[model samples]
Target: MIQNNAYIELMKETKQLENSVSKISLRLKTDQQLIQAFLDGNKESIGILVERYQRQLYFLCLRILQDHEDSLELVQKTFIQVMEKLYTLQNHNSFKTWLYRIALNLCHNFLREKQNYNKALSHLSLESSGSFNDPVIQEEQSLLLKEFLEELTEKQRNAILLRIYHNLSYQEIAEIMDCQEVTVRSHFHLGLKKLAGKLKKCGLTL
Candidate 1:
């Protein structure tokens, strides 16, 4: 009986060790390693990168496009473009910022095309997709505020989206946007001020 208890303890310790190693491996897997794997013709790493970023990318696109179908389509195209340009990426650590830059440029292009075709939205028509009730009014308020943010100047719009929608800090936004952090902060503050004014005039306030 004593030997059986000792054997059980040993097995438990081995299982715990294996679990710990697995966790550490995932955490330790950097973008650099993943990029190297891709360069070495490992397709699985590319898939892992897509899995890691798909949701975040989707949300970012949705914030800009405000249409679920269009957002998903844009994200799919972004991933495809990323794959095509994988060889051109120099610094693996810059992948996130690079991806944001690409997606943002694509959105700008799309907006430009839409403008040419005279299909640009006025930003006030972007309604959250659900029945409005007293309970969810607070949540709707924030989304509407974000929608109003799209009306700001391009720099302010990008700064607000990067900071508020994507939850990036001013430093990260500056890096992705190729501007100084002070510029990003200035844009965000001014953008918020303009957004508040617009919302107040429209009779929509949280």
Candidate 2:
């Protein structure tokens, strides 16, 4: 029974991957175009959207959850929500930030449920301490940055992640976080200061 279930799951994943590839072959130029296609019942349009944002969303979730499987699960859920709610997105230009809001909300729920923020941070600190020989320094920098970010309060961390990693404006972050632009700026600057001080103690510079 377990074998049959596993086989079924594998086939489902394979079919999804093939469908994704077929959609991606269209090479849609803009997110708005993709959304229109999706609204017009072109399911492949969503495949394109997922392909574009999945990596960044995955890393964003990883930085928050500090768990691979949890991040993957949240990314999947984010996309599912995006597909379901695509009709409600009024401003196509804001789709990226809107998608981010979905992810951040999901991450918030997951973190609240686990109530293990400190534990997650500690685990990331330990993980970051062990590696210096990674070939991709950019990736290493991102991991180290995430480890440092874990030291922050959730609001500060989210602000910094959206501002830095995602290149979101403070106004956009405020909208996503349901906070004021001033609050977003405060969280981002304070988070950066805290992270800088911590890194300085470790003889590292931001």
Model 1 regions lying over 4 Å from their true place: 1-28, 116-150, 198-206
Candidate 1: tens digits of C-alpha lDDT, residues 1-206:
99999999999999999978755564457878877887898676777678788899887777666678877888888888998998998877888988888887777777687773123333423333334466467566656665565567888878866776578878889888888999999998998788768766755553
Model 2 per-residue lDDT at 90:
95
Candidate 1 clash pair list: none
For every candidate, C-alpha RMSD to the true structure in Å: 7.6, 8.8
* TM-scores of all candidate predictions against the true structure: 0.70, 0.70
Give residue 25's lDDT in candidate 2 (0 to 100).
61
lDDT of 2 at 141: 53
lDDT of 2: 0.80
What is the Å distance of residue 29 in model 2 from its true position?
Answer: 3.2
Could you tell me which 10 consecutive residues in candidate 2 have the lowest summed lDDT?
122-131
